[model samples]
Target: MAVLLHRLGLGAYRHRKLVLGIWLAVLAALVTCAGVFGGKLDDRFTVPGTESQRALDTLGRTLPEASGAGAQIVFTAPEGHHVTEARYTAAIAGAEAAAVKAPQVKAVMGPNVSGAVSADRSTAIVQVQYSVQRAEIRPSSLDVIERAAAAAEKNGLRTSVGGSAYGSNGVHIGPSEIIGVGVALLVLVVTFGSLLAAGMSLLPALLGVAVGLAGLLALTPAVSISSTAVTLALMLGLAVGIDYILFILSRHRRQLARGTDPQESIALATGTAGSAVVFAGSTVIIALAALSVIGIPFLTVMGLGAAGAVLVAVLAAITLLPALAGFAGTRLTPKSGGKQAQRSAAPDGSDGRATLGARWVRTVVAKPLLTVLAATGVLVALALPAADLRLALPDNGSAPVASAERKAYDTVSDEFGPGFNGPLLVLTETHDRPGAQAGAKAARELRDLKGIKAVLPPQPTHDSAQTVIQVMPETGPDSPRTARLVRDIRAAAPGIGEATGATVAVTGATAVNIDVSDRLSDSLLPFTAIVVGLSLILLTMVFRSLVIPLKAAVGFLLSVGASLGTVVALFQWGRLADILGLAHTGPVVSFLPVILIGVLFGLAMDYEVFLVSGMREEWVHTGAARASVTDGARHSVRVVTAAALIMFTVFAGFFPLDDALIKPIAFALAVGVAIDAFAVRLTLVPAVLALAGRHAWWLPAWLDRVLPDLDVEGTRLQKASRVVHREPERVS
Candidate 1:
């Protein structure tokens, strides 16, 4: 393929020129297409699900009955007595005036501000509703909410504003993208040392993001993505961009040091490193594609967006990066002897460590059975924690500075109830025509529910087919009481709505997450079966042996599990939580395992294919399984490590987001890359392959006879590509 590419020179560089043109077209299209994702649509609007989803939907209808935009706020103090007459009037008056001045706020109903103080009188609950439009998100509404929430917080009062649309959006997903990008870029700047290079390293990121966003636009007609799309795009983009550029740049630097003419060097650097980049990129794509098995739209879209971005970014790295490197000249060349450079400047990139991995590979090829047992043991150990897993989505609200909003939420919970700010949406679907009668029954049932503090009157929805009921919980949104209430609601809802003959499915962020988990688990077999099964097929075709593909699948699973276990031990298990500032180890983001497996599966395949292909090539030549495994490991280990390190550095560097959404996924990915690169890809795999011997290829003669022969390395294309060198252009 490399020779074919070289022979086909893209007019200027022949095949190299072709790669350049491909990059130009892909990047331009990706950049231009990303704009199509542009629209007035906001993806963050939470879809309906388990509890809160039902609550929000139901509350939207109930809001009008209470009139005004139907809002509430609470204030708390440690004192045991009610406010003095003067203090009460002043606080109430202050709230009233603030409401009046706030635009789009028709009025502040209830709380009366003066009364509604808690039983202890230390806490004051103000239930205020607006006679305004429902503003899930509007700049005007945002401004009003921020100002009103801030102004309403008084000197002696601890205030919190709940039931405002603007407040929810601002708290949950705000400034997170800024923080994620800022943190990721900061790491790259430190790693690269040159601001220009650091900036250059971001090309893949920009490209990846651009491509992912473009893909979102392209895919929007088919799938409704989350409002968190941009954030998700940024995370995947940063990792792919950094890793893609890291590998290519490392190769370029190595080439420059070897004194290859700048242009010819460009060909070699891109051909070798670019091939690795392309392969790794394909692996990422496969992994993200694995998320298709997850029934949740959130994970599905994220997987698609991330995988698509990675796909484009990989193409960009090998094609476009080399095109640019063709112009970078000496800029890519490393300075002599950084501290580590002085220690070892060998071409093998090992910092001169003993080659235990290759030696083990040799031993394993001699004893394939022993290697299988060993790899299986390592995998079982890593997978055990996964068996005990549970899932939850916590508020985990850590602001830039602990803001008034969070404190206010706590204060309000103390005064009114736990669900003051968080409401659960109850969707009651009946075979009978939807009308007030069904709603009345739902309302009564809601009010009777144990945690139910209030049931706003049911209202008709845009669909008009379902009635929405908003039920407030007895505890704060994130408290255990709320979660328990959510579960109880689900259990009781079906029976409660039975008289109305309404079918109820509870859904909110919390319930949606629970549903998502249930759905994800349900789909696990099909998803796993698809990825694992497809991988075996790809390997079967690539290696032309049934035994080899199975072995590859086994090794890949071990590496992925062990990698996951390492992450679980550290992040989820509380080993390095504090050190990483991710002290919240609440069962990991509900969707992380799926994302991790998808990614790790692909990467494991990458190592497996690269190693297995090399061994197969040698085996075909030597007709000795043990020698083939040993020699293949010896020759391919360096390239694999270099490829793996580039990916590892890029992923590990982006670990500081610390968001509930990103922490587990990022940590899991980092561990997968590190362990795959170091342990499984290096030491364990080779040892096992060495141990498997001829018996690893177990297909009956009839099956072997029928299979098509295919080989990835040491083929005619490889031999031809190595033979040609385009004339080197003088360094620009």
Candidate 2:
């Protein structure tokens, strides 16, 4: 592996201009194609085979009106005025009439028709039903509704338009994202101590992200890409792109600072660090691509999209970074002074005055048990809040406070009830014409169920073979009570079916969200098992050690638990919500735990491989595990620290964005990176290694024989180089 990477790196370096040109051309073509052919991102969340989704699909065929996108234009009369009064009636009626004339609107139900008036009669809902799904509903259809609402506001009615049809599905890149890139650039400059090197590091990362994102968007014309997928891809692409470059470039500069030939150094660096990059990237890609096994379409897209981006990042790091380094030549070599020169002069890179990493590792090894217990204790304490963690998909109530959707959601909750925003559509499909009364009977049963706020009269289809019953829950869409109600209704399906001789299925935006959440929840444990099991196998193969991989997995879980606990506290419990700019709090996004496990597992392995490989490499040479832990950490800690910080800043930058979907995910990744890198990988890993001593690298002979030589530490390349150098000396 190292030899192949060495030749590839040398080839790229030799033909630097060609490599640069090819990459630029590819990026340009991808961007142009995306700009011309990319379709809009869809935010519609659907899970096939789930009861809610199956019901919705059935409705699409048997009763299109109920399956199509829905919207609500909530109108509030002036204080001391009722919407039913003659003065306010005209404006409400006018808005309803306009909504009826709107393009793609199949039906418009006013307060009088739908009985949607608030108890105070000061608020009313004009329900608009479109003849298309949310993704298919044109923006013009929503514009027409908004225009009517705006006109009605002139008559002293406060109006807001919102529903499944509203809200943006496009990924927004704001100043926060740019600021993240800027911070990453600063970290690179500081790490390399050269503006030229920093520019070289950031250039390839930017290009990789551009190419990856463009390619993703280009496929949108054929594939239904979600905004969350795009955001996740962007986040992973940029962070991994820079970190991968950092790994290879830092190795190259260190070799150059030690007076190695610049070209030879680039090749060796690529062979060594690039090998780790490939393995690390593969772990991430595998973890992400494993999302496919769950069989959820949107999640599959997200995982695959992010995996593709990481693949691009790995390619650019090995190919483009080395080519760019070829252009920079020996200038990337550190000056003959300061810590760089000092460390370069040392045979083990840990000789000179003790650096922070060296001192820290020595102290850790001095009292390994204490360090382990303390770090583990801190992580466990942080993870305590995870016990109370609840999972649910976001709704308009969780939207930005100033957004029209949020305003509408708030108004509906304040006036009518929170359930009005997320009423369940209970569909009763009768097998026989004699069972037409099943709809009425089902409605009665639903109303009698606990958590029932209001059950509208069932509306039968023209054929009377099916009926749509709107059942409102007492709580909001994101409420746990609402989720319980959904489950309760489904649990009663068998009873309802036997009594009415009809199949009962519940679906709506709210019910679908609940079903999606439940699906994700059920998949979490198995997905985690897969990721952890894969991590054990991959890390064992890479490190050729049993204890090391076990330690890495345990540390990864600690970081993940701590990160998730923090998210639950801040995002779910609303602790420090004001400081974080969170406008509302509810259950954590359903897919977050699964995403965190996959993403953080890969990232934790990244730190593990880079840091532990150094220790293993040192041990292989010196055969002293304790000294290897300290010395290896000394060599790798700086680069790993910078990489972790770069990742943290990049992920953290997205946290402050107004995107509810992206915010918690970004924050979780950021926190996970920080905790894993600083605490688990750097601190706990060294302690465990120290405690294990020589046993840390122990692998049964048969197990070792079974594992292929991955050469992640470039041991083969180093040995081959030594043999080549000795051959000339022997001849002399």
Q: What is the clash count for each candidate, in the order shown?
A: 48, 0
lDDT of 2 by residue, 1-732 (tens): 899999999999999999999999998999898989988887778888988899888777777878888899999988998888886889989998989888899889998999998998889999999868777887788889999999999998999989888866788799999999899999988887788889999999989999999999999999889999999999999999999999999888888877778888899999999999998999999999998888789999999999999999999999999899899998888777866656766776744688777788889889999999999999999999999989988888888999999999999999888988888999898875744588888887787799999999988765568899999889999999998998899899999888778889899788988988888888988988888888889888988899998998888889989999999999988999998789889899999998899899888988898999889888988999899999888888888999999999999999988888999999999999999999999899999999999999999999999998787878889788779767988999
Mind giving the per-residue lDDT tens digits that candidate 1 earns over 618-693? Answer: 7878888777777666545654665465555445544565445555666677777777666666656566555566
RMSD per candidate (Å) reads: 6.5, 1.5
Model 2 segments more than 4 A misplaced: 434-436, 726-732
Maximum-TM-score candidate: 2
Residue 319 alpha-carbon offset, candidate 1, angstroms: 1.8
Question: RMSD of candidate 2 to the true fold?
Answer: 1.5
Model 1 scores a TM of: 0.75
Q: What are the TM-scores, per candidate, against the unseen true structure?
A: 0.75, 0.98
Residue 714 Cα positional deviation in candidate 2, in Å, after optimal superposition: 1.4
- TM-score of model 2 vs. true structure: 0.98
